[model samples]
Target: MFGVAGRISPGPIGFDVTMIAVDQPTVARHGLTIVADHTLGDAPDLDLVIVPGGITDAVERDDRVLAWLRDRARTPTIASVCTGAFVLAEAGLLTDQRVTTHWDDVDALRERFPALDVVDGPRWVRSGHVFTSAGISAGIDLALHLVGVLGGPDLAVETAHRMDYAWTPTIPEAPEGPQRGT
Candidate 1:
């Protein structure tokens, strides 16, 4: 399965692997299972690709995974969590498309990837085939959105309500999070 790099904590000088399981209460309630991997290089045929945020490092620029993501986009729907949007941005997938990312990464992400039409707000955002979220916890929100979109609003709502999470908005929310960002 394709996965994004992540860290549990962002600190003064360093951090640890924040790679987390792509689990959603709603998804789980539906008997879903999401595996965790360090990179997206393994899956050759993916129905969907998900990237999550963390530190900005060499891996983010890894041509191997980037190329893999680029190539995979032709078949499966692609998505990101938080700053993972940066990965897709670098791969040149966000061009001329409206997308959302973790509030903290918005400015720099926008400046770094001018082609992307980045918007502010919401715990999660979906533009066309590319889905993005606010932050770590927001990943769950993004997943629910996908469930809603792919499974139907009723399913989405049921999933959200089942998970005890709030429903996503049709429009995006204003960005809000930590003090530091792009």
Candidate 2:
């Protein structure tokens, strides 16, 4: 939900060349605002950083967000949903990392970030510091995965069952070797 960059749109007042902000609240509700300052992950700091994504071109190039993401990298948990993978990828955190995103965005994500082992249709992925989800709907699944990892199996199971949900990840075939995290 941390949208560091602003959304843009066509300008009013006959200014065809200049654009206007698209009222980020329209897109990022729940008390959205520009991040005035400060890098993330100083010590006595963040436990987990969640980057939820939106427009691609704008987010990929944001300097502030990228720096924070890189800072957050050394911290314990860094997770993303949907196109937020763009933020993590932009930070180069995905180098040699296997990750996932909304199913439709994976190809372009890979095209934009070749260093990442971006899979085709997985609901999510967890590799080292990065945890990503395909949550084009299944964000809850991804969140549950984090809950399982952080809180242990029983809490995760209870959480999922509370929603009357079954944990069904779209796992791509594990690579040629035994799985690394298992």
Candidate 3:
């Protein structure tokens, strides 16, 4: 809801979010099969890509998915929700970068990807074009931050207001490295 529906001030603060999958009739970790708007093969070019976390073992090892993420490495922004950071790290996109994931997966992510400087407290962390969130709800905060960056702070505030979310609009600083926006 950080896009068109979030427009309260009406100043061009809208993003066209699309759901893409490596294959159709994709089943989530909870066994909920979802029909995506596009598959990787025919997906249109996007300015931002947000990968949601789950039981991501299969997708993390899929060559097609990795290749697609690598190809989209130059996209303005690439973000992850919770364990999705593992997939990005697997694709070699988060080397030497500070990132975060779900609280429960923090140690595992740190162990699996030694190259990443995984921090534990931040709801979300941003290093250059890559953004990673702590867990499910943190993704919403990150998306709102993205809206603030892409659109404007006012729009982000309006979105939070409309959603009745207690959005602080403040981003936590990474332990090290530059936090650049898209």
Candidate 4:
């Protein structure tokens, strides 16, 4: 997810991206060892903070990560991809805001954070400075949207074209009512 966001920037968007983690030598769920470029304590105050979702149960339990998220939420534009919304919700950041997570986790998110207005099917949804995307591929869509927000529609389109990605400028409305099996 960070890779997607990072790639979008410093091209036409002109954003300086950084990868930070709560700890160094971070091992991702897929067993990828991510040597974080910055630790939470060492990261500069950010204009944007992106939380990429994976292993939500583990992340939601990390008080230190939640604390950092809570602090950063006050200033930067915070975003979450997939189950990362759970992390933001755990940090008390998603209360009463419309959000979406991966389709598979939407019910869990709503059950866990009843205060959150959890929407189900948009590729991504934005409420104020916080944005949440549905799943993995949707993160790229959200990143493109952010580029549109920060840069401009033309730049976003250009960036998309440069990457050979078919970017959708507008997200369709999610269907209303309980999803199947809910």
Best by lDDT: 3
Poorest 10 consecutive residues by lDDT, candidate 4 = 173-182
Off by over 4 Å in 1: 1-41, 168-182
Across 67-176, the per-residue lDDT of candidate 1 in tens digits comes to 87778675435678888888887777777788778887889878987877788887766666567787877887676555444434444465566556765534333322
- lDDT of all predictions: 0.58, 0.59, 0.82, 0.77
Backbone clash pairs for candidate 3 read none
Compared with the true structure, the alpha-carbon lDDT of candidate 3 equals: 0.82
Candidate 4 stretches with Cα past 4 Å from truth are 1-13, 171-182
Give lDDT: candidate 3, residue 40.
93
Candidate 3, 1-182: lDDT as tens digits: 45533445475434666889988988887699999999999998877888889889998999999999999998878899999999999888889899999999999998998988999999899988799999999999998887777766777787788888898896433312212222
Decreasing TM-score order of the candidates: 3, 4, 2, 1
Cα lDDT tens digits for candidate 4, 1-182: 22443465544434666788888898998789998879988887777788899787888998988899888776547888999999999998889989999999999988988988999989999887788999988998988777666655655676777777977775323422211100
Candidate 2 — which pairs collide?
A: none
Positional deviation of residue 15's Cα in model 1 after best superposition, in angstroms: 32
TM-score of 1: 0.65
Off by more than 4 A, model 3: 4-9, 171-182
Better of 2 and 4 by lDDT: 4
lDDT of 2 by residue, 1-182 (tens): 01100011111211011111223213344545543223333323455566776666676787765776676577566778888888788887777689888887888988988888898676678887677888555566776565555444454565566667777633232222211111
**Candidate 2: regions farther than 4 A off:** 1-44, 168-182
Candidate 4 structure lDDT:
0.77
